[model samples]
Target: MFKRVTVLLGLNADAVADHAKASATVVKILRTLTTTVQGLAELRNQLGLGHGRAAPSPALTRHARLALNSTVTVTEFVIDTWQDRIDRGKLPPCSQ
Candidate 1:
């Protein structure tokens, strides 16, 4: 998902693993966003929300909440950046 977002922004890399070869700004954002997404993924797994584990996973309410917030922040940043590009005509408008 993060890769898709970056690609839409015109970054060449397709995954976080390729961050090492990306430009400085791309690498920086990818590193930070990658950490946030990883934390969110871990929380989802531990909470048994997406993982195919049995019910009654260990509860970490506070930590999970924080992770969810972080996830939203990161997601919004990518979305807003994309929208800004469109508004500024840096990116083409969506076709009907």
Candidate 2:
């Protein structure tokens, strides 16, 4: 998903060696967003939500809810930035 986002932003995912690259700004934002998503994935795994566990799980606490909200916010920002670039003709429209 991160790779796809980078590509959509006209960045070379493979060429991103560091945050100082030409596409660093957008890449860094995407990387941070990716990390947030990864954390959520890890939390899910820890809660046994990734596998079929017979044991019942506890309810989501405040921290979990905050994490979910943060992830959504970052995702929306990335999508909005991409769309803004497209709208400004800075990026090509996605191919059908």
Candidate 3:
């Protein structure tokens, strides 16, 4: 789904992330965030309690904490970038 984010924004996913990291276009690189979001999806699908798994989750408490923190990081980056675009008059005018 995070990969789709770049697409929705009319960007090539891998290219934009690579460029962001290499060019320092923004304050920080976002390539690893793709991996983090993907990993979280896999972990939740395979071992999450909601999946009705028979075995106990191999994910430790620390791992879950890290996932939450990573999610927050991604969320903040997205919001900040979105606001930056609005500030720069890059995004289309809001209907409202």
Candidate 4:
């Protein structure tokens, strides 16, 4: 007999830990994308600010650069791992 459960319970027929890991991976990618875009926007805003009015603080520039770099690295690592797993037949194609 089939049973129904609320999504709130987060039940899955597939390996629960694998499902969770996959979800976390996707979330991390999305978060990194959002952060990278936001960082770039902030950097642009700092550039647009006139030099006469206080210069873009070095700290802000440094922080933005660091965030952008981290996001890029994280995204690349996730993508590579996902692709490698799929290529090696370790993971099935994800479907919605």
Total backbone collisions, model 2:
0
By lDDT, the candidates rank as 1, 2, 3, 4
Residue range 1-96, candidate 2, lDDT tens digits:
765776676543533445466566756766777778777777778774548777866646886687779878877876876897799798888899
lDDT of 3 by residue, 1-96 (tens): 787764554333333554656545332345567777888888788768775678888988998898889889888877766666677676765577
Range of the 10 consecutive residues with the lowest summed lDDT in candidate 1: 11-20
Query: Model 1 scores what on Cα lDDT?
Result: 0.71
Which of the numbered candidates is closest to the native, going by highest TM-score? 3
Cα lDDT, all candidates: 0.71, 0.69, 0.68, 0.54
Scored by lDDT, the top model is: 1
- Name model 3 segments beyond 4 Å from true: 9-28, 52-58, 93-96
Worst 10 residues of 4 by lDDT: 1-10
TM-score of each: 0.65, 0.59, 0.66, 0.39
Candidate number with the higher lDDT (1 or 3):
1
lDDT of 1 by residue, 37-93 (tens): 877777676675555676665767877678778978887877777787799787988
- The C-alpha RMSD of each candidate to the native structure, in angstroms, is 5.9, 5.3, 4.8, 11.2
